[model samples]
Target: MQVMDPLTSPKIGGNHLFCYALLFILIASHVSLSASARELKVEPKGSVKDLVQSSKATKIKRTVNGLLEVVLVDAKGLKDTERFSGGMDPYVMIKYKTQERNSPVAKGAGSKPVWNKRFSFRVQYPDYAGGNGYKLILKLMDKDSFTADDFIGETVIYVEDLLVLGAEKGKYQMLPTKYRVVGSNKKYNGEIRVGLSFTPIR
Candidate 1:
């Protein structure tokens, strides 16, 4: 019987190859798992950051509930819609949220009209009725007896900041200011002077 040299034996060489293959497989599997763990950790952090940014972008500012008073002082440079009638009967239809009021007609006032009217509205911030509740819409119209009312021009007032400040200070007032009025033709047809006040309810 001849004794085989273990170092040069075929079986020993085969065993070495098998050990190297096993070690290579183990290292590759470990590297793959580490990369997967890193991805799992990094993805959530990015997602969380995106979620935070989105939340901030869509955040709604704080608002208050209160009574809002609007004063329609006057309007000037209005378009005379009743060219055939010689003079225009201009009046303003004021809207706040779901509330609506109409100013007394300035019959035959023509291009310039004076209302000096005060209107009141119950306001709740972030109105549930849809649309901007803090906005006041003033639609100027020429009232005609024989036909439909003519749309002269319109103006808008934003009172959200006023309401918020009023909530903080119990009341807020905006002195009469002139806002440009736009007509149905999308031109600056006139200007309207208006004042606003907000009183927050406790």
Candidate 2:
């Protein structure tokens, strides 16, 4: 067989080279796509759960130490606890944490009594080690000369939210609001009006 000139011959090897290059390109494209898919994959749901739990574990619990000022405004429709009297000698016994205060008697003020007195207490958020202390108890009483002091009614004021707000803002105030007074019989005997303020220490 006669040999053909190298340049004049048909480029038979070109098709094979092109086929090889096409195969190589397809393989490289597949590899690049697979890598991109892996990079775009979302983390497992379990990992997301663990991240949320970690966030909660790192969250800080708020604590505060401050001064609390209370204003004893007045009471209305109190259960006249006196047996036979012109008007019951009404007074208030205020209790907060372990501290106690007594208001001067609203002598003969009867069903509606007004004290408008101010009292202060040294206070702490999480007042006890177990942490549930922001409560104020007001016990209405009738002074008696011969018998035991009468328990007219009582009202409880929860100051946890107010204290927390004060701690956040450095101070907070609550205008006089009425709270229902409950008697030993567990009935709403009257309503007591009071105001509160808290100031946090640096």
Candidate 3:
């Protein structure tokens, strides 16, 4: 003997169908509009002052030292913003680069000195690497809001040859260099400007 429930069967079937239809429409709309929005634009503006060496090095030197500075600015041209978090704590990194076209990922065993926004930071270069033409990348961020909001600037310094790695016995001359200011933010939406310094020691 078979018993059929007429009322409950139709109601349950209708509910399931309604739920499935609603889910399908939502998913379809999400797929269509996912790629139709405009991306944000962030720009940094600044300038790098100059590179100054403590005492000139001799030929084939193992260590080199110098000073770097950058003038901070804003989008409105020299207008100070709350973005700087009051002052900048600067940092400098010297990377042993393989070629002139290599990037930060190709760098190794770097040094970051304490930052000072007087547009001046002290930098130190290592003596050994596996290749010629080492690159110097300089960066700056907020001393207080380093993890929150701040500014960052970078410039490259190129050394001549790997042979100069040990040029400690001759006149160690450092050339002049400069960088242009630029800015970026991953959490907020805005534009930035500052004088950037990009001086590569070649």
The RMSD of every model to the true structure, in order and in angstroms, is 11.7, 11.1, 22.0
lDDT tens digits, residues 1-202, model 2? 9886544557647776677679989999999999999889676665424643553455426666788999999999998887576679889999887789999999989989999999998787645643336689899999988889899999999887676666665888889999999999999999999999999877
Work out candidate 3's RMSD over C-alphas: 22.0
**Better model by lDDT: candidate 1 vs candidate 3:** 1
lDDT of 3 by residue, 1-202 (tens): 8664543455568777777779989998887777553344454542121112212333324455543333333221211233434433333332334311211221111122222222433334553555543454433333333365234444444543312321331323323323443444333222223232323233
Per-residue error at 26 for model 1, in Å? Answer: 72
Q: Write the per-residue lDDT of candidate 1 for residues 35-86, one digit (tens) a residue.
A: 9988884435544335435534554366567899999999999978877769
lDDT of 3 at 172: 36
Clashing pairs in 1: none
Total clashing pairs for each candidate = 0, 0, 38
| Structural similarity to truth (TM-score) of each candidate | 0.67, 0.67, 0.29
Query: What does the lDDT read for residue 75 in candidate 3?
Result: 20
Task: Give the poorly placed runs of model 2, Cα more than 4 Å off.
Answer: 1-63, 130-132
